[model samples]
Target chain A: AVAMPAIAQSMPEVKWRMTSSFPKSLDTIFGAAEVFAKAVSEATDGKFQIQVFAAGELVPGLQALDAVQNGTVEMCHSASYYYVGKDPTYALGTAVPFGLNARMINAWFYHGGGLEVLNEFYKKSGIYMLPGGNTGTQMGGWFRKEIKTVDDIKGLKMRIAGIAGQVLAKLGAVPQQIAGGDIYPALEKGTIDAAEWVGPYDDEKLGFQKVARYYYYPGFWEGCAALNFFFNDAKWNELPPIYRSVLTSAAARANVDMQASYDAKNPGAVKRLVASGAQLRPFPQEVMEACYKAANEIYEEISATNADFKKIYDHMRAFRNDEYLWFQVAEYTYDNFMIRARARG
Target chain B: AVAMPAIAQSMPEVKWRMTSSFPKSLDTIFGAAEVFAKAVSEATDGKFQIQVFAAGELVPGLQALDAVQNGTVEMCHSASYYYVGKDPTYALGTAVPFGLNARMINAWFYHGGGLEVLNEFYKKSGIYMLPGGNTGTQMGGWFRKEIKTVDDIKGLKMRIAGIAGQVLAKLGAVPQQIAGGDIYPALEKGTIDAAEWVGPYDDEKLGFQKVARYYYYPGFWEGCAALNFFFNDAKWNELPPIYRSVLTSAAARANVDMQASYDAKNPGAVKRLVASGAQLRPFPQEVMEACYKAANEIYEEISATNADFKKIYDHMRAFRNDEYLWFQVAEYTYDNFMIRARARG
Candidate 1:
């Protein structure tokens, strides 16, 4: 009903496809892609629309990055670590064993020059990335039997992802890479001894509790698993500046909403899980220490050969140290007090 | 370069003014308003422009809500707690004594029905609100002297905000509400014995370190102070749907970026402050416990009379309890381990 501004009158109508690395059932993760798309559409008044396809619709989840890189898709939502086979450096883009947590990663990416460093590496592959989602500290995978010591890992076969699998292999465990849909059957049929998908919410969705009795805590490999939206560099550069800003803002909203969804949903899921006869356990200190040591050994070994990996790894580690120093003093202290008070009640 | 879509061709150009309750010098908090405005302009191709004014440009900081409500400005950026004088229910929109931290509040607002509940109350005052910024767990304050027990608080005059002041008054401490710029002089001239601001980064700017040698931490009263963008309900309803979505996305970006900026900057600021001879101290357990007790007593009294306050307060407490239970398991243990390892190194 109002007259149009000159700039708005010249805007272009655009449409694109987005493939997700998650299933539609795990709404928290997959839903983030939808959130991004919806925001873009709403902000542009449907002038720009993105169609979202769940994993396997266009390609397998693990192949999401390849699809974008090869021009099979213009953009896709997936974890950077899923492409570690192409470059170990990819793990740093998502997370690494004993890497920064959700808050720390966000701080590093947004203000600590992490995005610049990461984009420099990603440019080599013709991909542009934006943080799309995050699952706060995930639970340790579901295990058929308890893990109390490093020796327990010596003969275990576990389904894991990315660099974490390599870290486990160093400790004598046989690591298996399985798709999300296949993890349950693999564990049920004795193909795998343990498997981890995500935290209580997603883990509950996969029915892992029915098959595995011992559900563990502190997914060490993924202190926080951040997902990304990968845009084909050529396609990204072709967009009008206004659309680019809209996309960036949309991705940022999805990033915060995903974590908030997980934090709010996980509490109730954990309660339901425990009531379903799932035995909750924390990794023994001995196992955690050994894994921590082993993880560092692998990082140093990789850093010696790969310049990109070494550069990002060193930067992230430095940032992580400072974040911990500050967190211990105030954030941690306050949370610790609240936790104790809740327990007392 | 490209032809405009039909919807874009009819879009209207709109300009509005925004007043902020913070000065320009406190960039992390005040700058969030700038960030939101910039994003909106960029996304709309300058068709929708918002000009942001710092406190006192349009109205004094404390009058931000009044300016928006009475149509002096279309919108204003402020903390909901700043208007507790209008109604105690205002405190729940930002935070309350010993309430949820930054992450928890985001989770509660976005997913646990917090935004809906708070907006129901906000609508009564002709305002529409969206979370715009957050300061992660803040420092307690700058104190002229160490407080060892409840006795030390008996005659102390502290500059505090909102409901925290009432909680402290119950403990025999005198509470003073002073504007941000005046705090340094108040502490220096013995007008107030202590003052609490956001955190290390903001506190360092206020030169509180020069006035008070003792810097205490874990500001229990304001665990995480969230800021909001308040729009005049009539103006909000008149916006094009596209403009509303663009504004919402922009505010969300500002919300996350502010916290990220704080987390990234505070560590360096803390190091600098300590190097300059600021003594870091934690509140004694006895005093913390006394404050905690007093805070709950005050909440109970408020809930007994205010139906809106009781409804939201009870919901937040229940959510807070569940959140702590989950946090202690994975988030806390992971952070605690990382903190100790950092210490050992």
Candidate 2:
């Protein structure tokens, strides 16, 4: 009887295209798309194949969301914050300055009703989304000179992205939106005084350590950058239930794997970067306080004008507060002890 | 041609029995097995079905690994530390005293060669393992009295599991092994001085707060407990590539989701536990340091005798050290700031 039902529910072959907002050379992020595609194919016995395209093969990197929305490609893997110009709500889908970290966000999305809240907003844009990857906590960026105070940020031309750039703007810095490929040249030519990309592995690949000697910790802007897979609403609905289930599982696999890859690789990369003369520095407490204040101000301003942004922001902040409370009790204490023990050894 | 290949690769009708070393009431842990089963069934179009059995249904919870090894069950969901009596090396597969945290362990398992190393040792027992779930950093336990110093631990009868019990033994505490269902009664009847179960979510369900009023935090012995899916090696090899891929992806989904569920649920449960008269306390630094020292002594003694234990311990400790170097720089600083801000609010 089980065999008969399985035969009746025979799978149909389906092929789709996935465009990523990252170049293939940055395998940790770009490779997530490949990982997703491979899992889908394997699980479906090659019946469901998704061809992955690095940024620019189908369209420019920034235009990936547009491509998925307009049906040029059935889906895309990109950072949700890249589309913040459309609405600040988009930033919540990825990361915002002083927001939830990697673990907190995953918990919120998978168990705390985050996906439902986000999908409800995405519906109007003709897209459906699933978390695809995370970079963990990213480096603040590479800087040519040390910043000792908030005053140092004044008039500084920095290549940053999303609402973080807006937060920095409130503190008198000039934020430039430069593509990843161009950040190196911009920093080298003095076109930008500083640039923030990912952590050590990807940053070292781009050779930011050569031009900028001062490397900062904890990119306050992007605490943990969550990459998402956006699918055309109609196309997503058209899939058989089994195919959808497979894709969801595959995306989850990519989501967890990306962070694991980063965590595994960044340790070696950080050591290499430091050995190559990149000075590791923490942002001054005064500067961090100022940025925290500015970030909150920006959130208040956005909340005053956008209901969608306000709803998600309130929900996430509540969840975040509770998360930190629990973390402080066990996770933080255990980690602090271990870190100290490791340092002593 | 693609359709022809897909049709030819029709999935086989297979049924499996999965025994979990968790009770049905503890949904977060037991629920992971259900999550894995659902994914397998959905991906296989109902052709592949896995029937899940809670602890004591088919065999005792502690015997889950033996069931898989002897082919009494195709697989089992359990913690490797339960089998530490067989080999101290088994503790490394789950969590040992002062082991890696949730994110760190996941990173190590998936990317930092943890699975390869673990499977190598597991092979001798005719078992193959995949990370099934993690509970994040757990609460210390419910204590009938406060533990203010190393002196307080002397002659204390505590119910703890695995290597932690041995570590406590070095500190003059008498450790008792009790099943999940028996811990509450032991604590209530004054048969045990203290009992460490899971975090607030599961502990509350077991009503430990009613018997033990002093709730201590930061389960140092298990920074994170990683549950595992132990499959019979021969049966695992016999599966088609498609089935294997599906199972791998499904297990990953469960692995990520379990922590998410716990993270989302624990915060609320903790508040309720405290509200209901559980006085939360942190283990004093003096006691922590003593336990830490004792744990290392045990490690040294075991490492000298067990080659497998030494090899994995050295590798994991090296990885753990490097991970903390990175985490302290960014992750810790950022979280410390946020926690302070939340407190201020």
Q: Which candidate is the best by lDDT?
A: 2
lDDT of 2 by residue, B147-191 (tens): 988989999999997889998999999999888889999999999
Which residues of candidate 1, in runs, are more than 4 Å off? A1-10, B1-10
What 10-residue stretch in candidate 2 chain A is worst by lDDT?
A1-10
Q: Highest DockQ: which candidate?
A: 1
Error of 1 at B309 (Å): 0.6
Output the lDDT of residue A215, model 2: 96
Q: After superposition, how far is residue B291 of candidate 1 from its true place, in Å?
A: 1.4
How many clashes does each candidate structure show, in the order listed?
0, 0
TM-score of chain A of 1: 0.97
Task: Give the CA lDDT, 0 to 100, for residue B318 in model 2.
Answer: 87
- Displacement of residue B189 (Cα, Å) in model 1 is 3.2
DockQ of 1: 0.75
> What interface RMSD does candidate 2 have?
1.3
